[model samples]
Each structure stands twice: as C-alpha cells, then as structure tokens.
Target: MIEVQCQCHGRLNELLPPSRRHRPFTHRLKQVMSLQQLLIPLRVPHPEVDLALINGDSVPLSRNIRNGDRIHLYPDTGDLDDPSLVLLRARPLQRPRFILDVHLGRLARRLRLLGLDTWYRNHMDDRPIIRLARLQGRTILTRDRGLLQQPEVTHGYYMRATSPDRQLHEFLARFEPWPWLNPFSRCSRCNGLIERLPESEVRRRVPPRLYLEFRDFFRCSCCDQIYWQGSHYERLRRYIDRLGV
Candidate 1:
C-alpha cells in the first residue's frame, strides 16, 4: 500500500461540501498510481485546468505518484506566479464559449442573454456533450460531478450552486466574464447571433400595437425569432443591473 499527503488550496476546497473540505488529508492507495488516479477518489473535477505541485515541484496529471509524496493543488491562478511552475491545461480560449449539461438550461439562457456563446439542448446526452466540447474547444459547465470527472473534459467546471441566480453569481466570480459581456446580442432559445431588423420587415410578425409602440426590432439570424423592447426588456435590464457588470 502507498500513502500520500494531499492538500488543496484557494477556492478549490470550496467546491466540495463542508464534510469533504478537509485539506492536507492523507490518501492511501493499494498501489502506485498517476496523479489523475489519486484525484478520482477525492472528487476533484477537471483537474487539467488546475495546478498540481508534488513535493515542491510542478508535475503533470500523468506523473506517477509514489508513497510518502506530498502533493498540493491550486485552482485558477493560485500560486501560479512561480517561475518554475508548470501548467497542466492548454491556453485559455480567446473568447469563452460554453456547452452546458442538461441541468443548466436556465443558466445557459441567462448566459446567452448576456451575448455569450452558450450551447444547450435538453435532450443532449453526456457522450455527445463531451464530443462537441472537444471538437469546438468549448468549456463544459455542468452540475454533474461525474460529467466533469471525465478525463476527456479538459476545460470544464462543476457548478456548486443549485439556484440559477446563485449559479450565475458563482460563475461570474470564477470566470470573470465581464470583459465579454454583450447584452441582448444572442438568441436565448437557439444560441444564434441576433441582428437589428428593419421595422417594415417585422411589421407583420408582431402585434399592431407593439409595432406602433416599439421602433427598434431585432431577429435571430439562425432561428428567426423576433425581439423587441417591451415590458420584458425592463425586467431584463433590472436583472442585468443586479449582476453588477
């Protein structure tokens, strides 16, 4: 049997419940294993995006772990300024795009409402989700720990919050998507680009009263869904104000 000392720093521990948040814990293994293997039993999701130090030296997830080794893990820029530190994941996306699992539909729509590129379908299974994420270089945002635990999901996160509002708050804090925020720019239903449409084009599509009341109109390029500034716009504006972006 092999025994190793492991510790998680920064907000990494916050991802777990209080009962499992203990740091500097001892992990015992029946045989020598890779660093990824060690993280499996500890419920560390998407370890590729994290930094791992072994006995004061940085190493890859595939690095073989031995008995009595001391390991420390950090998430999202924690202790990353060290000159000798090594990064396990690839470069960050120039513009963040996300593919959410089945449970994050509300969050996905909210993200799209902010003009973020978000792909979501209620009927999508895990296999296709991972496959699409891999192909498009999109990050996977999921509430399922098991989905994030998949080795193929290199860029991913496990949302700890249950409610959609809290989940958005948590995501904003973690990813800091403020730089890319563009409100009312995408189709909330189909995740397609939205463009301003001439009033004459949408005159027949909308109610006569609405057409007379609202001068500005928009339509989704892919889905052709019409949008206008109305009562819902005020509520949406208020909600965006609450986000503090």
Candidate 2:
C-alpha cells in the first residue's frame, strides 16, 4: 500500500468534490499507478490538459506515483515559463485553430462566425477529431471530458457549459481568443475563408432583389456559398455584438 498527498490547483480543483478544493487530500493506494490513473479516483476531469508536479518538479502524467509523494496538479495556463518548469503539453498555440467534437457543432458554427478557424462536422467521431487535431495543429474543443483524457490530445479543452452561448462565454474566458476575433470573416457552414466577391461576379448567384439592394457581396472560397449584407445582417450583427467581439 502507498500513501501520497494530492492537491489540485486552479480550475482543476473545481473538478474535485467541494470537500477537496483548496486543501491537500490524502490519497491511499493499494497498488502502484501512474499519475494519469491517480486522477481517476480523484475525479479530475481533462487530465491530459493539466500539468502535474511531484515534489515541486514538473512531471508527465505517465510518471508512477511513489509512496510519500506529494503531487500537485494545475491547469495549463501557458504562462509558466521558468526554465525550471517543464511543460507537460506542446507549446501553446499563439493563433489557435479548433476542431470540435460532434456535440459542439453549434459552438463550432459560432466560432466560425467570429472568423476563428474552427473545423467541425456533425458526423465526426472521436478518432477523426483527435487525428485532425494532431495533423492540422488544431485545438480540440468538446464537452466530453473522456475525449480530453486521451493521451494523443495534447491541446484540448473540456467545455463545461451546456448551452452554446454559455459555452462560448466559457471558452472566451478560458482561452481569451478575443485578439483573433474577426467577425463575419469565415463561412460558418463550411469552415472556409469568406472573401469579398465582385458584385458583378455573384450577381446571378443571389436573388434579383438582393443583387439590386446589396452593393457588397462575399463568397466562401471552399464552399462557394454567397453572402451579403441582407436583411438578416441586422439580426446577425446584433447577435455578434452580444458576443463581445
């Protein structure tokens, strides 16, 4: 049997039961286990995105817990830059791109509306989401804490809110993606860049009344979808304004 002192910090502590927050809890283990496994019993969600320290030395989750060990877990704030601090995940993304899970389609579209590079599909499974995140250097966003626990997902977040708007607020607060927000700059439907198209070029694509009333038009480079400052623009503008962009 082994006895260890475990403590959680920052948002990670929020995942623990109320009794465990802001306090070091004694964890008794009957058998040896990795740091990742230790989190299971502690109810720490999204362990892969968290940093672990043993005796004040940064360590990976794969490190085995020893008897009398003192373990500290922290959220990956991306600001810990001392040479003594070892990063548990890849370097922080300066300009983050995103790949959301199937459950986050609404959030994905909302992110696209803000001109963020958000890749999402209703049919995407967990494997492909992780694969795409790895191959394209996109951050994974999802409500599934289980998916964030996967070892391959180095840059991922578990969304805590249930509603899309609340989730967006939660994400903005956590990731602070405000600097990259360029509203109405991407195709929310296809995750494509929206480019200004000559009115003459898109004249036939839109309705006659729309072409006559709207002077400016945009088109998605990937999906060829046409956009314009139509009647819907006012409502969408109001919506975007509420997003605090």
Candidate 3:
C-alpha cells in the first residue's frame, strides 16, 4: 500500500475523512494508481481544480501515485495574476463569443440585448456544452464550477455574481466589451443582423399609428422580426448609456 497526504481547502473538509480536517490527512491506496483514481475516494470534484502539487512539484492529473506522496490542490483563479503551476486548459480568444450555460439564461438575453454574440440553450447537456465551446472556439460562461474544470473545456469563466444586472456589469468589467458593442445592430432574440426595412414595406408589421407617425424601421434578417423606435428604444438607449461606454 502507498500512503498519501492531502492538503484541502477550508469548508472542503467535509469532503475528506474526519481525521484529515484542518490538518494533513493520510490515505492508503494501492500502488500503480493514477492521481485521478486516488482522488475519487476523497469525494471532492477533482476535475474542477486547476492545479495539483505532489511533493512540492506540479503534476498532471494522470500522474501515478506512489508511497509518501504529499498532494495539494487549489481552486480556480480568484484573480488573473497568479503563478502558473498547472497547464491552462483554455486559450484566449481574439474576438470572444460566449456560450452560456443553462443557469445564466437571463444573462445571455442581456448580452444579446447589448448586441454581443452570445449563444444560449437552457437544456444543453454538459458534454455537448464543453464540446461546442471547444469546437466553435467560444468561451464558456457558466456558474457551474464542475463544468469549468472539464479538461476538454479550453476557455471558460465562472460567474461570481448571482443577480443578472451585477453579472452583466461584472462581465463587462472583466472583458471590456465596450469597443465591440454595436447597439441595435444585432437581433436580441436570435443574434442575427438587423436589416434596414423601409416603413412602406413593414407598414402592416407595426401599429397603424406607428406607420403613419414614424418612417424608420428595422427587421431581423434571420427571424423576420420587425422593430421600430418606440419608447422601448429610448429606454434601452438610456440603459446602455449607463454602462458608461
């Protein structure tokens, strides 16, 4: 048998054996076991953790277990500037597009409303979500720490805020989408370009009073949805103005 010691984070003690809490905990595992297999009995989700150290040396999750291995694990980044111990899973994008997880549906709508290219599906399974993020070169925005930990996920972020407004502000501050914001140019419902539609053509699409009063209109090229500058336009304009860019 091989003996290993784990250094766990506060509040994560419950996931470990009682004797291991608040101190170095020891466990016995058979020889020739991988680090991933050794972590299974700990009950903590190992995949979400970004770095793991064994005897003060960085090792991959696939590293083999041996006698007297001292292991340490750390959560994902709370700040961007930190020492690198593990290989980063995701690559940064040149012009980032987002694929939001099931939980952040409201934030997805707000992103689309702000003219950002965001893809959202409320029922996407975890495997496909990770696959899509990698295949399409899109960033994964999720509240699920487990999903972010998947080795297949190359670029991902955990949403720190719960409220939709705060979440939007946090994302905007982190990614600075100001230069990319193209207000009213994207379809808020489908993420497609909004095409200019003459009032004469879309007259029946709008209220008869609006057709007579206003001459400017736009239509979604993908969904055939019609739009006009009504009170909602001014309201949205004011909201964007408050975003400070």
Query: On residues 140-242, what C-alpha lDDT tens digit does candidate 3 reach at each position?
Result: 8888767765656667777778999999998997688788887788887777889998646776677788888877889999888888888998898898888
TM-score, per-candidate, Cα-based:
0.93, 0.89, 0.70
Each model's C-alpha lDDT? Answer: 0.86, 0.83, 0.77
Task: Give the runs in model 2 whose Cα sits over 4 Å from its true position.
Answer: 43-50, 76-81
Candidate No. with top TM-score: 1
Q: Point out the worst 10-residue segment of candidate 3 by lDDT.
A: 82-91
Cα deviation of 96 in candidate 1 (Å)?
0.9
Better of 2 and 3 by TM-score: 2
Backbone clashes in candidate 1 total 0
The digit string of per-residue lDDT tens for model 1 on 90-130 reads 67877799999999999999999998999999999999999
Which pairs in model 3 have colliding backbones? 90-154
Q: Report the Cα lDDT for candidate 2.
A: 0.83
Ranking by lDDT: 1, 2, 3
C-alpha root-mean-square deviation, each candidate: 1.8, 2.2, 5.0
Kindly list the per-residue Cα lDDT of model 2 for residues 1-245, writing each as its tens digit.
Answer: 99999888888766778888989989899999998778777766543435788998888777899999999888864676677665666777767899999899999988998899999999988899999988988999887777877767778877778899899898889888888999999998999999998757766687888777878889999999988887787888999998767
